[model samples]
Target: MVVDIFIPCFIDQFYPETGFSMVKVLEKAGVTVRYNKNQTCCGQIAFNSGFWDHAKAMGEKFIRDFKDCSHVVAPSASCVGMVRNYYDEMFYNSALHNEYRTLKKNIYEITDFLVNILNVKDTGATFNHVVTWHSSCASLREYGLKDEPGILLRHVRGLKLVEMEDKETCCGFGGMFSVKNEPVSTAMAAHKVEMALKTGAEYIVSTDSSCLMHMQGYISKHNIPLKTIHIVDILASGWEL
Candidate 1:
């Protein structure tokens, strides 16, 4: 199946390798992958920040950018959730309503697309490490993703998928929430890191790198004995670095 990947600003800016890994995993599963250079932000940041006008503008561009795509998959759940769930506020009953609806139905988060749509659980990935899954708030509540990521992780060779305390808890990286409430955000990240460390896990794996990025900052500042890795990176691991 041919799929277009929507690389969010978080992945495109910071964890670029993870984006490449996403492509590798999809290709390994025998799916055709395409990245549209014309694609930009999904207007989530603006939308979340209460800038409806700017958000709608960006959302319109995003919708038009992938208008012809059969299926649009994104590595970050938050980005996918923004489009699938939040775009309704700006586009519903509007001029772009029909187009927005089409995009919403066609877009999907990576794990959701892999396990549910593509029916792919194994991608020949081998990551010999004890890792815990961090179910980002958006992935769980907004995207309604529960067992999809776990299904894919279980098939990875040498990867022990341990459960983290409050895996469903928010990582406090609520986009603008992190910046607006620095102390609260930091404390939340600390709590999450402590939980992941308690599992004796070497890596805290998650679908949203924004969460990973937030936790990684705290982990690095305190020199915590843990690292953050995206599931795409883990799924693309196995045979190579």
Candidate 2:
């Protein structure tokens, strides 16, 4: 199963390891991964900020970048969701509509591709840590990804997965939302961090690195002992502990 891996801008810039970890996990599952160096931002930031013209240009570029690929997968659900859900609105009533429709269907968030499409639950990896899962807003609401990550997490050799309060709540990293509404975003993230800490979780894991990165800021500033790790990294950890 050959698939093009779309590395979201955040992961590509700030957390490149997670992107590579995603590739590692996919290969472990017998997937041949292909990466297009020309791939750039999914334009989600622009779209969310009401910059439709900029977003439309980005949407078109994204489609063109991966048009020849049969399957497309991304680690960030937010990016995947943007391409799948918002591209239509970005390119509505345009000649690109037909191509956009076809592109969206071939694209999948990594966990969705692994669990639903591949029917894969375990990745033969291990992590001996007490952790709680944070379901990013886009993964839960946009992509309707709830249990797929948990199903895969449970298969880790020695991971003790704890359920945090309001696991499905947003981590408040709506890209520009955090910057434009700093107070509210920080408050939401602080509350989320508090909840995860209360669970005695050493790590807060999620399929979306964006959520992890947002919550990580609060965690780091307060000198909290907790860490944020992407699910792909966990699955590819492979007894590294």
Candidate 3:
């Protein structure tokens, strides 16, 4: 199947490798993927921060960018959740409302696309390390993604998926919340990191880069050996590591 890929802002800038890994994984799976260079942020940052006008403009741009694609896939669940869950509300009563509805239905998170549409559990990946999954709040609660990633990870050749404590708890990376409530964000992150570390996991796998970015910062600050990995990276390992 042909699919259009959307790379969120942070992933584009901070985690470009994740995007590459996703492309590699999809291509290896016999899926034809297209990347729209004009695509930018999904307006999630502004929409989440209460900047409706900015969000609407960005959402319209996103809709226009991939209007012809039969399906639009994203590596970040948070970004996909924004388009699927908030685009309609952001464009309500606007000229682009109907367009937003059509675009929203085509958007799918990577794991969701792989597991649900492709109907495949394994991507022939191999990572010989003990790892645990971190369900980002947006991916878990907002998008209702519970088993897609787990199902895929379970089939990886040498990867062991351990259940981390409070798997559903927020990782303290609520985009604007991190800035507005630094103290609370840090406290929550500390607790989440503590729980993750206690699992004796070598790497914490998640679909959203924002959560990994936040947790990586704390992990660096605390000098913890635990590392954050994107699901795409894990899936693209190809038994090499």
Estimate the TM-score for candidate 2: 0.97
lDDT tens string, model 3, 137-186?
Answer: 98988888978999999899888888888988898889999999999999
Ranking by lDDT: 1, 2, 3
Highest lDDT model number: 1
Candidate 3 similarity to native, TM-score: 0.97
Can you give the TM-score per candidate against the true fold?
Answer: 0.98, 0.97, 0.97
How many backbone overlaps does candidate 1 show?
1
Which digits, one per residue and each the tens of the lDDT, describe model 2 over residues 1-241? 8989999988988999998898888888898999999988888998888998898888889989998888999998889999888887877788887788889889999989999998899998989899998988888888889789999999999899999998888888888999999999999999999999999999999888778889999989999999999999998996454
- Residue-level lDDT of model 1, residues 1-241, one tens digit each, is 8999999999999989999999998998898999899889999999999999999999999999998888999998899999989999898998999988999899999999989888999888888999999999999999999899999999999999999889999889999999999999999999999999999999999999999999999999999999999999998986764
| lDDT value, residue 173 of candidate 1 | 91
**Superposed Cα deviation of residue 77, candidate 2 (Å):** 0.6
- Please give the range of 10 consecutive residues that has the lowest summed lDDT in model 2: 232-241
Over 4 Å off in model 1, which ranges? none
Q: For candidate 3, which ten residues in a row score worst on lDDT?
A: 88-97
